[model samples]
Target: MRSFFRWLRPYGLVVYWVMLLGLMYLETVNNLPIPTDAEGAAFAQNFENDLSRNVFASLIEITCLYLILRPWSFTQSIGRVVGALVLVLLWTSGLFYVAFNADRISNVLGIHLLWLVVLNLGLVVILIWRVGRLLWRSLQQSRQR
Candidate 1:
């Protein structure tokens, strides 16, 4: 875990932010249909119909969050911090879009509320386990000293 942090620390936060934003932008642009005179509003409606893509986009956002937050230490450089803030704006915007359109996505997916509840609960459990593991390792190291 220490080695993981050490390896990522040098890679710089800017790289992570760029990758997140770039992938998100690519996904959004690629999936969204261009509104033509004939197609008009229907183009957008078509894009909204794909629940799988919506879920995929949300997963991308989650991955981005994981990458950005993985390092316990955010950044050593002020420049990187500023860059991350900018990237965060893009990330938040994407999240907001997803949140607002969640109903539509759920409708398209034909998923029940219980499933969403279960998924969130599962995530919580995973997070708790990871934190516990980290804390246990830290305690073990301290005891060795």
Candidate 2:
């Protein structure tokens, strides 16, 4: 499993965002009826909308990915600190988005709610776990000295 993530680490955040947004675009556009004049416009609009709606979510997911992969284990303490700070900022942005866009949840309940809640909840858990792990390691290192 770790090896699998190692293979993925090089692809980084932008690749994942493109893949996520592409999948989202396909999902949204594929569900529609046959277009007589303008499915392109609709698809474009949906791509834009998905891009907008998911900006913070994408940021959060990439940070989660970095935490799970933990490449800074190969580098230095500064890398880890930078990664953690980036993760916290992205996670906080996601939280703020939810707080500001509460009504969006009801726009498509059930599955949508599950997607929103589960994804954000999973991110929160990952962020907490990574931070805890970092702190524990720091404490252990300090005690050894």
Candidate 3:
């Protein structure tokens, strides 16, 4: 048990951030409007579904930033980067889905959501690139030693 805890120490930050992001995602998703089959419903209803998704994506961006700025065991840092990249990919694909199905997404949230998605995607890409560069530099320095 001690060994397990010791191994997890370097990853504690990532675990905490992931838990916080999950909680935020749950809260936001709970607040989104849900469709009901009521008589004579309007053709379009304000859904705001993507609002939660956008916020979730922002959390991912922040997580990546944290991983890049913090020092950890190399293995733990690599794990954090891989996890963040997977999340970014998932959210980016979801955003694309929303863009392609604009009629449904727009009905839920306004067109501004599309811009928000684009902005988040760009941030994620830049953060990933910067973190990758840092990791490469560190690897090269270790090799030189």
Candidate 4:
């Protein structure tokens, strides 16, 4: 854990947190003092969708974080394979999102996204290491038989 943090950039994390706060503020803007009912309805729908998506994303991310902390917990648990694949997809999509929208993100958040890129990379590194460990263990077990 300490080593992971050492490998990840601390300043980028700080920037990310600050950007989250800024996003929170931006979320509230929703064009206050609406001029018409149509605008109000649009705002409500947009807000609800964004809020729901954020909640869902948070849940998935938290679950994946737990797996990252206990990679071996899923070893030999065939039922968990689907969940693992979902996480892999999530991270892959996240990376693509960042890569495709780097300029837009920077313009909105006014900060470099290197920290986020590094974050995804770190998670991927853990996944690779975990897979390697599992393969080695399985190979050793086969040799012992």
For candidate 3, the TM-score is 0.33
Candidate 1 regions exceeding 4 Å error are 1-5, 9-13, 24-39, 43-130, 134-145
Whose lDDT is higher: candidate 2's or candidate 3's?
3
Candidates in order: C-alpha RMSD to true structure: 10.9, 8.6, 9.9, 9.9
**Candidate 1 local Cα displacement, residue 100, angstroms:** 2.8
TM-score of every prediction relative to native = 0.30, 0.37, 0.33, 0.36
User: Highest lDDT, which number?
Assistant: 3
lDDT of 2 by residue, 1-145 (tens): 9986766545534464565656554556565552333544221123335534654555665667566546545333344544555665566566557745753332212223334454456445555766777789999999999
Positional deviation of 72 in candidate 3, in angstroms? 10
lDDT of 3 at 6: 73
Clashing pairs in 3: 47-108, 48-108
* lDDT (Cα, 0-100) at 65 in candidate 3: 50
Candidate 1 lDDT, 64-120, residue by residue in tens? 645645545543333433344455555555554665676333332222222333334
Alpha-carbon shift of residue 129 in model 3 (angstroms): 5.7
**Number of the predicted model whose TM-score against the real structure is largest:** 2
Error of 1 at 62 (Å): 13
Candidate 1 is scored at a TM of 0.30
* Displacement of the residue 5 alpha carbon in candidate 2, Å: 2.4
The lDDT, on a scale of 0 to 1, for candidate 3 is 0.54
